[model samples]
Target: MYRERAIRLAGAVRWESVSAGDEPVRVLPDGCLDLLWSSGRGLLVAGPDRTAHLSVSAPGERWVGLRLPPGVGPAVFGVPADELRDRRVPLADLWGPTAVAVADRVADGRDVAAVLEEVARGRLVAAGGPDPLGAYLAGRLAAGGPVGAVAAEVGLGARALHRRCLRLFGYGPKTLARILRMRRALALARAGTPLAEVSAAAGYADQAHLTRDVRDLAGVPPGVLLRA
Candidate 1:
């Protein structure tokens, strides 16, 4: 199993990452935008709105991951999930100018983590301090899924949550909840548990509920992952 976490870089930016996985693993649908960047192997991403897939398999055991912000739509990356029917972009292209800087930094014997930190610091002014989006995400993640509990934690009404989420993450609270829940579900599925058990462990209502979620997010049934 791969243990992944959100890293706080030099700036107020963060990226979800995995350290190991010999073969290219596919990231199923999760209702969130993943700005993946690779250091050793190339990553292939594909899928439709709300159901994108990413495949990264390289020879060397190196670092690679996705960078997802709190907001939605393409602020500066590739096309937003809602805009295209199906598309794919290389990890290098996602960062644009930042990628060039990262290359130079890495060329100068800097680690990817250090480069990420530096890039983050350069954009620190763009985002700093406690962000509404970060708060909302933290609340959602801590709740183990997106629940009404987040509304209370953020001190916002239901309508206010929608508005703030729109202003911050692009997608609404419900959308984010689905995405986070799917992420947890995928993690559980990868752990080699039964579909029904994974569903319950991932906070789904039941096996059918988990199946629906897996099908919607991953474009494949839970059985596929189990067999793999």
Candidate 2:
């Protein structure tokens, strides 16, 4: 079972899951960072993924996570997003003693989700909050704004924007734009929109284009994901 809800932290979500060990769960690229606690794996951080991550779980294992959106994670972790891309690392690797303290609390059987949220909130506050540019960049790309236009909108030239994107999003603007587009299409398709219409509404040239893009990043066709 899986469930999620918006939390007090801005643009962040709290989620919990009980993995049944049925099959590998396909984790799509969503330009986000997750602070994760798995009963089987202890505490870890899930970095921004450029492609799908197949997570195989042990039956009855429990997990709780706080997902911090895009640019916010770099702030919370005090590391560039690119440094952590497509990787899941033990929290102690980065947070060290701080993460160990949290692990002790988890061992004490506290509400792990709440604890994760508190950790994220504390780090975000100490870092003085997520970069304002992050929200703007993600919002614009999600809305289908062209990359050049977005860079210009933010008073940055092309190269500067690319550098910032790598540091903040783990990818350049073009890749981020593609991932955001496919995610929007996935959302629409999951909502029961017809595939053809989903492609059109998502600004794809056709359903075939959507299929190729989805397969490239998600490692499966849209039909498969919809079934999952």
Candidate 3:
């Protein structure tokens, strides 16, 4: 089974363990990035995705990952989030010898999550933490606020907000909002809420709106995704 736990780190939401299974798992966009380590594949970085990611695992393969909260990834990774958008790159490519050292530590069977967290914490501290405005924008957008309103609240104009979002989230504010809304709807639906209520409560215009979004972002309808 898959397991996840919250960890104490700025911009890090949790650590996760993905179970090895016969079938692949569909990971939907959640406006976040991940630093992942696999028993056989070493270390990799999962970028912010605009659509569902079909993750496959070999038999007996185990995986550990740290999910970074929105707007926090760029600072920790030392690049604009768009640079890694919709891609998984070898950690060595980004971190050089540091990634190799991390792989060695993982091979030693130490707590992979803790190692990854320490690495991220070090980078964030060196970088002076995430941008306060970006963090504020992320929070407001994830809360289902309108993009225009969020920008205004943060004292940013529309164009300025778009630029900041592209740098921090790898996409525009509208796209980020869409992804966050889909995540909210899915969480509610998986918890056994009816589609109609989920659509309304998640800020969609109607069930059809929710359905279209689910299909577009997740590559499946809500029913199929939930069943999976």
Candidate 4:
């Protein structure tokens, strides 16, 4: 009971879902953050996660979300990404009454997803939009660039790049790279490709390497995620 569509926002997507049953949903980490509205919770934010998140839903609860790409979240949320890592905070907690006003609009029969998109667009503009550095760093790491080499490519030292990643992506370059690699490997595996080939194609040393990394970040083996 979930569906999503790409929106005009850069690298962002709008998604809606309804809880179908009582089972806890397995939400894998994807190096992104989400602006969320729950029927019960109103306005909320989902931070980047370092590990898998088990989402327990009340039956038929509706959810609307605007997912911002990794670096884009820090720009829109106006908080360092690390502070919200693995956490879901009420939007009011950060924006105070301004967020409550946004919640009120959505609750008043306005288009839920559209309201979220409008708010995000407004905030992104005020913040001067997303930083170019974040996109470059994330892109390089996701493309299998070596951490040190990529850091240098950005004219940043290791520690400096690490600091920037913490502020922008809620993790260091190394961890972000691992997460990106895990996602890539999983996507290939889900395409019915063999794990061995997936590992090689996704830049892992071998199948065992892929298994360990996936289990570490996602809290499950490759087969488990595929079946889910």
lDDT of 1 by residue, 15-97 (tens): 44554556666655444344334555443222233564555555444553444444432333434444332455553555566
lDDT ranking from best candidate downward: 2, 4, 3, 1
Tens digit of lDDT per residue, candidate 2, span 1-228? 999999999889999999989898999988898999999999989999999999989999998999998789999988999999999999999989998999999899788888899889999999999899999999999999999999999999999999999988989989999999999999999898999999999999999999999999999999998998
Looking at model 4, which ten-residue stretch has the lowest summed lDDT? 21-30
Please, what's the RMSD in Å of model 3?
A: 1.5
- Model 4 vs. true fold: TM: 0.98
Q: On a 0 to 1 TM-score scale, where does candidate 1 land against the true structure?
A: 0.60
User: What's the true lDDT of residue 41 in model 4?
Assistant: 74
Root-mean-square deviation per candidate: 5.9, 0.8, 1.5, 0.8
Cα miss at 162, model 3 (Å)? 1.1
lDDT measured at residue 55 in model 1 versus the true structure, 0 to 100: 58
Two-way TM-score contest, 1 vs 3, winner: 3
**RMSD in angstroms, candidate 4?**
0.8
Residues 116-187 of candidate 4 have per-residue lDDT tens digits of 999999999999989899999989999999999998898999999999999999999999999999998888
Deviation (Å) of 57 in candidate 3 = 1.5
- Model 2 Cα shift for residue 215 (angstroms): 0.5
Off by over 4 Å in 4: none
